[model samples]
Target: MWSVVLLWLSCVPAGLQAAAVYRRDVPHQKVEVYSVTLDCTVTSRFAHTVMTSKALNKANSSQEIFFDVDLPKTAFITNFSMEIDGQLYVGNVKEKEKAKKQYDKAVSSGQTAGLVKASGRKMEKFSVSVNIAALSSVVFTLTYEELLQRKLGHYEILTRVKPQQLVQEFKIVVNIFEPQGLAFVEAEASFLTNDLLLLVDKTVTDKKAHISFTPTLEQQRTCPGCEGSIIDGDFIIKYDVKREKSLGEIQISNGYFVHFFAPPDLPRVPVNVVFVIDRSGSMSGIKMQQTKEALKAIFDDLHEEDHFALIIFDNKIIKWRKYLSKATQQNITAAQSFVKRIKDNGSTDVNSALQEAVKMLKNGHRKNTIPERSTDMIILLTDGNPNSGESSIPVIQKNIQAAIAGNMSLFCLGFGNDVDYSFLDVMARENLGLARRIFEGSDAGLQVQQLQSPLLLPGNLA
Candidate 1:
């Protein structure tokens, strides 16, 4: 897990919620933020960074100050520390049981302590509070590392800023070094304005780039009245590198060498896709409509080089065609009509449905009807647990594994909160694929479009 675990004399008010930055300054909040800086260094595929925050308590009595930052869930926190009037305290790792006991003791006795938790899909929330002595200052420093993953085309690194009060010095610096060569660099921020664009400096060369965002106190204000800080969004940096066809870019340093190869402009690998959908009675009303809409859009995105099959299951499995059909216009139209006529009824038979889909793909590959160069994939979408035919998760997983034997990738989409997502996730991972949660909403269909993921275009590094 890419999580940051911190233990110290950290505490928060009983009812305070987790937040990256305060949206607005509270009247009794006497902590004054003087300076803040976040620096990121990226070398090829890995990134390491630190965040430093300095604040002073101005009230006559001690007050609580929080250090909150949001980071990608795929990042690792290496170190965390706090300095109070020159006395420093650092976090040390401990066994889970021991740590839990210590945390409970601190909280029960009304001593300072805090907890870390997830915030969103891509980001984890790291928050801690410490009581600052009156008229004294505190410094909080955090360091972390992550392996950058390229999506679509570029790699992105970002920081969330929610400093409720304007600081005299607020700066962010990102330095990236690519072994091949710098293709292009772009800087953006949710809170960036026309006038603030000048502060977003970008300097690029052959293999290195330095991007900075240094906004002044006046620029960070929400308005002339200064009711809240305007620096309340993400500061994101995106960039890519030049690539060679075969030899790629190999860099030797210290004693070891690394080779990075991402072949550019390669034709999309032809795929025989089996979309296994659930029409169990639970999938009625808007859920059914959204699934239909999503499927139609997906069919439209199919390429001539691809072949697809549609299978809908309730208690019994139904197929639109007896075999995998080319993504020609006629076949797509027929599939769409079959989907529009689908009605929700009967109990879920997830295990049998999956096994049947896998059987179809395996049979096609064996019959030589599907091209030898084409890949077979099962995109299974369901909103409920198995209720018929091998309902046991372990049995279903073992049976499917034996049937496919790693011959095809199985991607699972668990729709709505009612799904046992972990069950689906394990099945996908066991079969050379991944699982995704399709959130229940109007945009549910759009989420299905994410099927065109990094799995399609893989970059090799050694």
Candidate 2:
């Protein structure tokens, strides 16, 4: 199943006869967005919703109208639809290849329809564009689904708000119904201001919540005369549910059952981690320097109860030590120094690098130096696809999975624009871990440090 959610649906569809009602707010703008609404309903923490945005081309001639929205990266859009005036166009979603083919065929006549591209650190951009005759309106709707996972004892719902222009009527509403009873619920936005704060609302009962953020046209302006939108960041809702002490919570409904489990805090099990660093030529200047800084910060945060190893590689592998070293002050400093010495040279050998990292952990565990209860993982950082030494993606995935043998997790970080993010994403998924693309920027070090939020992967499941 794919992850999907409807973002806005506050405006009713009954009376949309006038293009004047759809105002973009910016005078002389070719298109007028009359209404924008996101309505999300969650039952037992499973959300079902859609976002609806309406725009009318008020120009004297045909003009290109675009509907753009940022979506959570984890959500998979299973179905998408667009209404151009009175014509309803429905599209099916399945395997990526098939779905893409359908999309290509729909707009084969050369008119634009939809485009989904990777956007931010945790969100993707879903865009739709159509050429509408003067006075015609367009309605865009997207459907996607994702199973929300608990992180740091709470579930978060994130929606990216980027309507491109100031909308006359804009609102987002989320309704949550939890049968087991809600522990707490809170909502906030990155663009919230004094006046916008008043528009944000949260009503939570033991078993339900109604959260909404509806800023008026005046409240969305940057200044008295500015027509630009102030709503261009993340809208987040965080909440959790009460859990029982047993095997978590299980509910039976309509002859089906769902088991939800996340036990309370348990004693920390020491982690055995191996840092697989890539120093290919592409990671020459800023990337290398930022990576070293990130590694130093990472060492500063390691728990003393944990053990770690370092493996830096391009075409060749270099080990920091013979085996895992305890995260003591002295060892962390030495590891930091080792990271600082990594320079850019040679071609990438991801396959060989990962194999050595896995072997080091497996060997340590076999030698009994690594505690049996400790969680083991490999964090592979690369800035480009392998251009040397077994560059085959499928072969690399197969070899790495076989070497790890489900005994540990593998999290991959792909850096820069040229990196093969999809390969890393698929590999990480197959290995019970996940992958994230680290955009190349001055804040790349902070991006690396932010990888700390990977939950349950290295935790002891109760």
Candidate 3:
């Protein structure tokens, strides 16, 4: 018998340290940020997600502040602006080198050099120093796109909230319009939801959806005597269009649109995939057993047109085939036998394993031009830190980046808390991919299947 344990980890830092900047004109007493006002507008037409955060300063002086905004990895921002005292300063996208120069100039000139950077784990941190003019507030707004995703026959959007301190006021309003008739709408939150209001148009003719969720910490019994309510976690919304068919649905109203693409009828683009498995000593027990079961099950789902390869690594690299092979029944049976024979023993040689996977994909691409139109992916599963050949993360990431060379996507699965998930996340981000952490106690095989099922394409709006 095998027992699995599920570990819930904090995805965000405990708190942000926004130290006060001292100056002659600055107030001697520390300024407290009393309230944070958040307004978000998500649309499906262009699939844009725009958000504005206003921070009010209580003390009568300038204050320095920093906050991290966590968004989906698919999001890309094109506009960033700050509004202060009825004046707006907008920032334009510039080359990395030019942007650095401009930022430096603003700082040296005693101007507000607000910085926005993509931190690890799908979060962006914004830092700015401004004079609030004694009890005033500064508003920062960023506009981005690619917040809509499709899963399990529905469209989904996620909004994260993790303010270390409770603000006086925090409100979030979302307006959605679907032409296919507002079929179904639902919201899920880890915090209290009694304060949230969902107003839907009963008349099918309206074809619109609106959701407003506000958290009230004062009424919470979990943390009593705390001025603000404990609000920390994600606010997720999932909705489905009423239409029965898999054909996508779109809705337009007042020059704005939201689309739900669920094309189950369309033939999936053929895929050439490589499953890179780790057989290090740490994975010797239930981990290895679950992995083998997962691989065998996945092989059964491969279409005839799709091709696959299997490579398991420890101290040395092992390949199931010299080149990619068809997903024929006989071949799949042979692969299952190969997977069953893989016993964990040696140390982890991630560097070599990744290189070999990329090499195989590149060679396969060169030999078969048809797969160029298809998607090439490497699903790497690792459970231990690299201890053999080229162990440094930077070196391994660089080599893998060079080998893939923007041609293929890499999906990483870190098994359990023992693996370095940060490394996987960064590498996947750089390679136009994503990494998922698989908990041990749960259905490990099911998680693997979920990650690979229906394979999301690059820039896929679903």
> Which candidate has the highest lDDT of all?
1
Off by over 4 Å in 3: 1-152, 155-238, 241-267, 369-372, 454-461
lDDT tens readout by residue for model 2, 1-462 = 121222212222433221221223334478888788998888876776688888898888877666677776556676677687777766543323344554454444343435556555566766655567788888887777665656787888988887656888999999998888898998888988877888888899889999998877877888887988898888999999887666666778899677666556756677889999999898887668667766765676688888899998888888889799999999998888777778899999999999999989989888998888888989888874887899999999999999988988998877754568899998998897878666443345555555664522245352
TM-score of each: 0.62, 0.65, 0.51
Range of the 10 consecutive residues with the lowest summed lDDT in candidate 3: 3-12
Summed over model 1, clashes come to 1
Q: If the candidates were sorted by their TM-score against the true structure, best first, what order would they fall in?
A: 2, 1, 3
Q: What's the candidate order when arranged by decreasing lDDT?
A: 1, 2, 3
**Residues 1-462 of candidate 1: C-alpha lDDT, one tens digit per residue:** 222233645434343222222232344367888999999999986899999999999999877788777877667678888787887767654333455577666555655544445666577777777667679898988898987777778888978888778898999989999878888899999988898888899999999999998888888888876757888888888888876677677778898676667666666678788999899887776567767877886788777777888889998999888799999999889889999999999888988888888888878888988888877888887875888777888998888888889888888877754568898998898898888765443255455555554333322222
Could you tell me the lDDT of residue 196 within candidate 2?
83
Q: Which clashing pairs does model 3 show? A: 4-441, 5-441, 44-258, 45-257, 45-258, 149-462, 150-462, 179-251, 217-229
What's the lDDT for candidate 1?
0.76
Task: Identify the leading candidate in terms of TM-score.
Answer: 2
Q: At residue 199, give the lDDT of candidate 1.
A: 86
lDDT pick, better of 1 and 3 = 1
**What pairs collide in candidate 1?**
10-113
Compute the lDDT of residue 57 as modeled in candidate 2: 87
lDDT of 2: 0.74
